[model samples]
Target: MLLQLDCLSTCLTSSGSVLFPITAGGGSLDCFSACQTMGYGQILHRHGNEEDRVHLNVGGVRHQVDPDMLLRFPHTRLGRLLLCQSEAAILELCDDYSPAEREYYFDRNPRVFLCVLNFYHTGCVHMMEELCVFSFSQEIEYWGIQELHLGPCCGNWYHERKDYIEDGDWDIRSDDQQHPSLDSSFEELSALDKDLAKFKGAWCGDLRSYIWLRLEDPGHSTASKIIAVASLSVVLTSIVAMCVHSMPEFQRVDDNEKPIEDPVLTVLEEICIACFSVEFIIRLIVAPSRRKFLGNPLNIIDVASILPFYATLALETADEEAAEENEDIENVGKVVQVLRLMRVLRILKLARHSIGLRALGATVRHSYHEVGLLLLFLSVGISIFSALIYSAEREVEHTDLGTIPSGWWWATITMTTVGFGDTCPVTPAGKIVATLCIICGLLVVALPITIIFNKFSKYYQRNKAMEGQFAESIDFMSSVIISTRTNRYQTDSQDVKDVFFSRSSCS
Candidate 1:
């Protein structure tokens, strides 16, 4: 008796049934777990070419659907609800069916691929277990009929046009009665059921729909070169102006003893500042928000340059006698000087603003591990050089080399070949140590410098290659857009000419 009960339970489990009653036009409960186990993809039912949609299958059953017939039914709200979670309101009117009914339907209908029972939900359908040809292969020895129906369970369902299903009055039993008989010639149903059973299907939505970003094209990269050159000029000139102010040479220079200035540098500085200032204003206009310009690094640099210039003009014009009485005017010069020097860091914009320079910066950052290794070796060399000099000069020389830190200064000078010649050893032993230290320092320093330069050179070459590729890509895209636009204009030449003249007149 226990074995018989187990067999019955297994048999009942093999047949698909509606787990819940679908309410009419309410909403769809997710069946993603069940759908995935089935052979098909997500159940989307919409009218039109939905080739990209995921399909679905019933568990423990398999069958191929007719493409033409599938197209005719297209997609239903119930299918779409099951697949994409769309058309939720439409699923509120459908109802669900019981297990026994589903088993009978599976046995009776060979053509029945999926049976969906409608509950009270208007457009939603609760999918019953699917029966395909593959499921039939496992049930070859069984004797049963697969009869399927999509009808209401218990409520008084009625539809004026399509409302009867909600009232539970719509009967699909007659439709089920027309299905073919299942094969059941032998006893053991377990083997056939195990072999024939398949899992439910799920829906995978469109991939492109997830992407919403619309980044503006960088435009001709030549534009970047122009902007970068202009920005660098503004930054460099401001830096030099600050440097000249700080340096003794400029401070000491009288009007009569002024050095000749380069006319080229002067013109370049003016041009750069003017171009960058204009660019900044244009960017501020295009910015999504006014605050965005203030927040942006480049925008801040532009504003800083203009602000100092205006502030200087204001401070200079202030009452000269009053300014002389107060030291505030003198302090303003120092603030102006600092503001000017900060412009040099704006040269960083060349790397940050351009894709080509950004790529180069990435390579430089990536090579840091190798650069660190070189630094480590240099540290070791510095220690060794310091020790040698200290050992040779500390005993009788009574020099600064008596300390490690003091000796390191000599090591640094020797390593860099700066050789200021401020400190030299008089002892024979100290001189010999110095000579050997200088030779070792040259090789040790040269190794890392060579390695670093080689890495930089390689990166430069790669960047040039990438720039060429980028240029070609931009050129192609520009040609396509321009040609397309030109064709459109030629097709409407009179309209184009009128619009162009009107725009010219307005300007």
Candidate 2:
């Protein structure tokens, strides 16, 4: 389908001379697209025109694009630009254009234009990682492309940016306020003051915001650093108490012959739980979004670490005397103790502070496909090898490979090459099967490990990149901001509009 050119009447430069290219000497222009042509469709000759070519200079990046491609979206500036069939219309696009060259120039970001160019060819928009999402979003609006037109890759990034911005992670500023002002504004606002404001977030007007900042961001202030250190200390103390409490010396037999917990260890764990409970409450209270705070993984870890302590206490208190006599209560107590092991997950809480730990976490998050593939490979190998090894050893008497399930354990151990020497085949056929299993296991395991490692390297690089680039993006935001002070002007505004776009689309 072709884009309806209702605005064809609005194309100012689309007079006869611009419809087709011509040499300065007055012969028909000769040009060809050396770039790989893509897709299959009659869209190229939809209008019954043979071919229309343009020598377009976007900023400094030049491209020989088909006019028919531009015509696919008639409402866009390029469509209107090429639709204008006159040489003068192309010249008006930029002041520095040399009429003798016949190349239309437009001063714009070449990186963003790459994306726009792709869109004209592909009909879907994408963003570049090097460019700020804000800048990209502005460019999309300028190009008259709706957010719905974003490709799947860029769409995910755009939505993530939206959620993050709402949480006040980024400062949403307009360019109208960034120009040099020597009077009341610049004199009153110090550089340090501006920097602090940028980090202070959109919730600066509220008193709770400062408190939330202290708890949420350790880099916020000295108080925040102290808070981080104190929280880490408490986590370490709790782990130590849990460990010491499990020691043999800490176990004492009471008068009733029931083992009792060491009071000192119990007291230490109680103190740690109390600290965790108070901090979680304060964080939940002051958080900007209660839903986001509650849903956070680290926050969930905090809750899990605290609940185990209380549940264990409740079960122990339910019937202290009945514990030795009642089987149900003893089994229930064992289950509660198992639940208490969830406290060990509290170690993951440090991911909030450690960049390396966060990167590792992200690596695990993104490498799930590889992880699944590894499991699938192992499952198939275990099933096949177990049966093969069982068939080979079943003929022999006094064999350790007694059954298929037993062979499963042997096969698992052999595939991993962790020969415990506890269960192995005495038969040559079984040994041959074990050798084959080991070789297959190495291949299956190595492939997924390589994929997962590559993903780790990728995510780690992105995590590191975000740290250095966030500040640069904030600074660059000023330069790209839309302002009425822009140099370009339009007599017929509806005919054309400025658009920004660029590159290796948000991969």
Candidate 3:
């Protein structure tokens, strides 16, 4: 700004010559007179870039620099100042400028300036080991050097710091403590917060809130913990029932040779579904935001896991009443089977009670991009190999693949390394293509898996850290949320309640 002001201050007279230039007379005459009083006027004419060396006293450290050499990068802070034609021009660049001693004093950090000085000669900016990435960046910014100028050796440290600040989960804790738009001292914070606050906590609903805490957060109370345990037990029973009745030992054949459903497992499933239905109803009634509760993915999972049973019942009743084609009945049965399979999603309900499951949930939520990249790589590899393999075996008489479309199934199974063997390469050429596909699959799959695993670890570690901080509160159950923190002693814990609210993603 000072340099810009100095440039803009220059004005033209009617003659249109360089009248009232900052280095010459007029407004600068005072600075020139002060120099004369200090004996600077005598040698002012000799003060040019051709001088042998310029003396500098930066933050108490003394140095001698060649004036011409400093002009190598003339756009920088010191470099721009060296362009000054007179002692008056150098006034803006330095403090305590003494022409008699021929030294310029600067209050800036002596350590970082050394790096700046090195850049003038070496044409590279090196970050100091003692300075943090942010501090080093600030110094360089002040010196008019781009952060991109940092050498490759230390670039990772700078880039890593930048990336972490922008994207990492490490800042959640501090962020929770510091309310957005309310960093003022206590009295002002209270005043501002009170004005902006909403009345949505447990106090507003009282008993409903109490019920919500129990059903939602096992850590809230003994009753809630018991409810969580019961919920978990019911979920396990439902899952087990779904699996067990399919076993040959549990099967019963009717007189017509139709398979009869196990009566005991049927009753067990009903009981579990009943428990889930009741729990969902209670949570829905008490949840601060019914829409948000319904919107929550875990809650959606709960509904998904429960609705299948009721739908199956409805379909079974319809089947008895309607005289439909056998194929149509089979299709309805398939639909019903799909609904039943949705019961498997009930295991995600366990995320409500276990931090590990919740962390896994969060990992999946955040790793979508990496997952998409993995899928994309797989798609390209699959398409290429499918075409290559089909072309290789197309002439073969007894090839498993009959068409390019058919190779899709082969390619999918092959790239996934599942190798169902139902569709495979018979020709040696196709086999070689299969080999390359498998290798590419491994590389493609491994890359995303590592990233997803890292995200899982981050969420898991973060959750564990929170659990450690609130060991007493989080011991029995998971409440809800990703990237949220809750202070248990707050006037109402629900002020920042999780949507599933373990608020492992809690605040």
TM-score of each: 0.40, 0.55, 0.62
Query: How high is the CA lDDT of each candidate model?
Result: 0.46, 0.66, 0.69
Which segments of candidate 3 are over 4 A away from where they belong? 1-122, 138-144, 156-213, 219-221, 245-263, 288-291, 311-337, 424-426, 470-507
lDDT for each residue of candidate 3 in 203-249, tens digit (9 for 90 to 100) = 45446644654665566668876887888888888878888978999
**Candidate ranking (lDDT, best to worst):** 3, 2, 1
lDDT tens string, model 2, 1-507? 211232121211323222333335432222112101211111122244333255578788877776677778877766656544344554453444443454567777788889999999899988777787777777767766778889998899888986666433212132125343211222323432343344334454245555765676565458878999999998888888777777898888889897787888878888888898999998877775668568766788788778877887787777565657664554875777696787787777777767677678756765567788898999999999999999999989988886899988998887777889899888999989989999998999899998678656755665566534433443343233222214323433523432212222433
Residue 57 lDDT in model 2? 86
**Residue 403, candidate 2: C-alpha displacement in angstroms:** 1.8
Q: Against the true structure, candidate 3 has what lDDT?
A: 0.69
lDDT per residue for candidate 1 within 335-434, as digits (tens), equals 6556555555555545534655644554455456556776686688778878877888888645777887887888778766788988766679878878
lDDT of 3 at 272: 87
Scored against the true structure, residue 382 in model 2 reaches a CA lDDT of 96
Better of 1 and 3 by TM-score: 3
**RMSD in angstroms between candidate 3 and the native structure over all alpha carbons:** 12.5
